[model samples]
Target chain A: MRNLVVLWMLILSMSIMAQMRDFQVITPELTGTLRLGLIRQNESLWLSDYKKIAAKKNGTETIYTIKHEWLNKGSIRISTKPLLDTHGFVMKIETTDIPASIHLFWAFGGCLGEVINLTGDENSLKPEFCKDNVFSIEGNSFTVYYGTSRKLRILEALVPPDSDVRLSDAHQQQTPLSFFNSGKKNDAPALAALTPLKNNEAVYFCFYKQNPKADYNYFMLPELYKKGSYEVHSETQWMKSTPD
Target chain B: MFKPLLIICFALFVGMYIKAATYNVKDFGAKANGKNIDSPAINAAILEAEKNGGGTIYIPAGEYLCYSIRLKSNITIYLESGATIVAAFPGAGKDEGYDAAEPNPDNPYQDFGHSHWQNSLMWAIGEKNITICGSGLIYGKGLTREESRLPGVGNKAIAFKECHNITLRDISMLRCGHFAVIATGVDNLTITNVRVDTNRDGFDIDCCRNVRITDCSINTPWDDAIVLKSSYGLRYFKDTQNVTISGCYVSGFDNGTAYTAQWETDEPQAPDHGFTVGRIKFGTESSGGFKNIAITNCIFERCRGLALEVVDGGHMEDLVISNITMRDIVNAPIFLRLGARQRSPKSTPIGAMRRININNINVYNADSQYSCIISGIPGHCIEDVSFSNINIYFKGGFTEEDGKRVVPENETVYPEPWMFGTIPASGFYVRHARKILFDNVRFHFAEKDKRPLFIFDDVEKSDISNIRVNGIKVENPFTAH
Candidate 1:
């Protein structure tokens, strides 16, 4: 009986591990890097050429910093620092010498499942429509909840905002959002549109996931946190905690 | 370890056997947020599907901001209910507009907008077997309505060039910059159950073949609701053939009120704009000519009437129009102009216009000034035209002085119903036509007008029978010059 029980547990654990992966987002999953527009112009950057990436692990926590620089044209520099826990991570972004509206787009690969809106309302945890403050995704067997420290704007696709497709002045029409490759819908990756970074400024966002088995309680948390201010509870403590 | 390996192998086998996969744009990073530009992610998902032979690219419900979306072969862009693709606002800077129209040497042959496909919010060129279908909305908010000869604005909601086997169904378009849809040199096209409410021209099928437009409701205040053209823009003289437009409803509303349906029940009448335009037409651009066409079962409300023009040195023949109902027509209910604008190359002389038939047409409240005209140039008379079972009501208020007015022969000018000003006749005017026939035709007016029912100027080989004026039989209604 003891041997049978050990074998059963081993199979169950293996299956569970296969079903639910540890919050390890490989390099490709987070393919987006920081971009700095020196002249405040609209141009896409190659993520590999401009990124400086580093990561450190301490106990059960990991810290990552990614900085990018553009030396010529406008001499722009931008950086993203993320503190990752088992559930998810929190990131702080800083930029310098951005002359005009500069955009940074990122994708969390396949980690986030089917997306549902978080209509912050009084009946639920968050009562307001935070531009894009909170959302939910379906996990392997349950719904997982995610919340951001700030109201992040989400985009269905990454198309340059100012591109025009009008060829003639007949009737003098203007098409502002033109496609680079026509007829291929949404060829660019889906990403979040961050608020434009100024010459010297930083914005903070916290991304934390909640298992639906645990009622979504973090909706009541405030947006915008300091560097290293968001702390994740240890596994032993989280396992024993009750609903707030 | 052996068990894990077995499981992995099984998974790989299953993955390999899957015939085609459904790719959600969300998986590729499309945020359905109302304001984000979603064209890139949606395009990426389509390309991914194309890479895998061909699959469905599914778009869930949300407002997706998009620019131009390139379409590939063997793909269907499926939009879930309540999904919308909105045009983004023109931000600062000139390059921020749509990709500049590709410079083609044939551009001088046609207007700037008709010469290229790149200057549209959604466009396909030289593609095959593509479809955009859903019970969704495409709102062209920030697209430009400016008519220009330059390449710096977006003018069309959807444009196609040299494409094949395209289908657009069950979609609604609102405020579609200039033309809601324009297909040039496209073959095997099907557009059904679509609605277009716009301020400018609706659908323009130019130099296309095998087109079927059915069960559509179009309201445009500024221009023609549906038009067929064969312009020299395609560089080659490809005749438009095998077209059937039926079971459709067309009308005009105020400049910006087509989508709101305000013209139906409420809203004060804005006749200054709506009454002047909005009708079905075939060519002001008849360079390549038209053939094998049938238009039937159409209704026109509160707009201009039907017009057929073969002015740009192209043949207009073998056309059959039937079962048309029109109300509140601000101009002549039926106007056919076959002129010698001579928009042909030096080697090509003017072409012929003949063999046209119109039947089962009813018009009410037609404008009083210009009667329905069938006109051709002095020497080149239109040939073999027939009209049957037609009834028209004119807004009678003309005096004897109006009856004596002689319509001019504006041969080379733009072809419009009102281009000749007031005509001498109150009902039908046939000028420079041969072998003309009218049967079971009735003309009436709300008030008494002392004008002839039919005036023929240089007409030849005509037959007129069974005509009525104000419910009374009139004998010899024809007055020939």
Candidate 2:
């Protein structure tokens, strides 16, 4: 009975801590060159204001949706839905107005994953290999390793037409997108276009992990991998998906 | 009465210990979603930590969009491996961006960018014993790269001013708007194992003392990768002294692609004439002197060569560079200049540069025409410089006429290799200097050249030993002084 009381007290404290600090979990995994659509409603608008607006937990999967607004001009939305059984996620993008050009720039070392490969949306866009990717780091690989074990692989899914991606350097001096070719890894964070915004014009992109399953824990969420399983396992089961 | 006082003292000591607690930003109403601006919660957590006489603020693996994270002394922000602190873009509302750049009455002396520090994603002013460490990322997504003062644009990733005992380690910055890290008037700084691959300047250690930067990799195509400056940003002649930069690599690659081993392609697009302004430099801003500096065991690739300048009235002394390697150099392999641009106080005179020792440098595929140059102003000559065990390979296609070309004395112009306009010497051009020595140095060219390897003008007390041209011992590889 005394042991049961101790266990109950521990549970009570845990619940209290969770209730006290209910900050939302922002996805740090998606980084580097972001995608923004240029649209014209009244004047010219670029969907540069990107922010995560909502997050929902279903089963072992969490879905995060980001909204992009062009300064009271227009709105666009994107969502990252993690898969319950794989190291992958589905990205759904919705456009409101037509954008002129799309620009993409990959960050040299960021959380988007190592050895990224993109598929989906009919594979209309393909990245080329570049040779100028050389850097030196101490006690780690030159390529940034994400997560605790650093085994996550970021895979791209879709690329819309009228898309152009390039490698740009130098702050304050804008390098034209024509300077670089579409390369993979840090070289190829590509941009795509969603022109002629019409009703119900939604596109899909999937950035899933391939052939990587590791169990680890970090300070922010130490209980994430507490089960020591490579698969997603959570005691707090949530709804997998709800009809819209 | 004594027993009561002792008890009270013990209680107070214990209370102090209890107050120093670990504050998690999430607990203080910080939503880790990449959308919400959580600067207030994070700042509150920091305030709570500060109130407790300094503590650790732990941020877990998640995306946190923040607007300006003001720092405090004696506080350590430990980001879990997957955690990221992202800067928010403008257009949220008015009064949202970083506090506009601090107004400096001494602004005209420097560029508009160098005069301020408050317009940044993360800034600390007049703090001490501060550290921002972890395997986390600082993504300057919404930060602007504009040099001019735009009230709504955030320019820098991390800026520290007038702080001491600063330690920045294991942080990766991407596309930092203007500069990845800018620390001015900071003392006793140790920045190690930091990776910066961005669009602009990497690490600008300005007006600092007792700085040790090691094991850092900076890949910036448009600006100096790692620079040491002594600007009048502090409005004084505080010297940058006792600095050591070792075990570092500076390279120029396409933006967003360095070290991932991806994007490996033939005929890769070169950035700006296949020459990146990526090099290690000292003082484009030299209001204060630089002394007791050493740069060793470093590598430079696909970029401009090493530049050491004292153009703005600042005395530089006791500098040593050794064990350096270079590849795919597009311009001169080395440039040492002592000029009289004199952007310092009117009372300050032209600076003096002396006692520079360079050893064990190897270069491959250097531009043959531009070659290496060490020049001083007409009257103010560089003194007591020596080079040993240096081997350089050039893409030589120069004729005797190219060798006889008289490089102009554009002393006041910005000190750059191309500024001299294709020097005559295929190996080195020494002018307006004294006590110069070259021992065991060889200059190799891909194509045979008619010009002598070295040129000397207005040189005094020159000593050359074991000099070779295309692997053959020449009677005098240096001539036409």
Instruction: Please name the candidate that would achieve the greatest DockQ relative to the true structure.
Output: 2
Error of 2 at B16 (Å): 11
Query: Considering summed lDDT, which 10 consecutive residues are worst modelled in model 1 chain A?
Result: A1-10
Candidate 2: tens digits of C-alpha lDDT, residues B1-481? 9999999999999987764567889999999999888888999998888887888888889999988888999988888898999887654245666666766767655665667888889899999888899999988876755332335557789999999999998988887876899999999999999988776789998899999999999887757899999888888887889999999999777565774634222223232223476789997888888999999999998878899989889989999999999988878889999988777667778898999999999999987767899999899999999999999988888888887788899988767777777788878899999999999998888987667688889999989899887777767776521
Deviating ranges (above 4 Å) for candidate 2: A1-244, B1-20, B263-274, B479-481
* Candidate 1 accuracy as lDDT: 0.63
**Chain A TM-score, each candidate:** 0.36, 0.35
lDDT of each: 0.63, 0.65
Candidate 1 residue spans exceeding 4 A from truth: A1-244, B1-19, B93-95, B148-152, B264-274, B479-481
What TM-score does prediction 1 earn? 0.64
Among the numbered candidates, top lDDT falls to: 2
Error of 1 at B246 (Å): 0.7
Candidate with the greatest TM-score versus the true structure: 2
- Candidate 1 local lDDT, A77-123, one digit each (tens): 22222322223333344554544655543222122222333222211
What is the docking quality class of candidate 1? incorrect
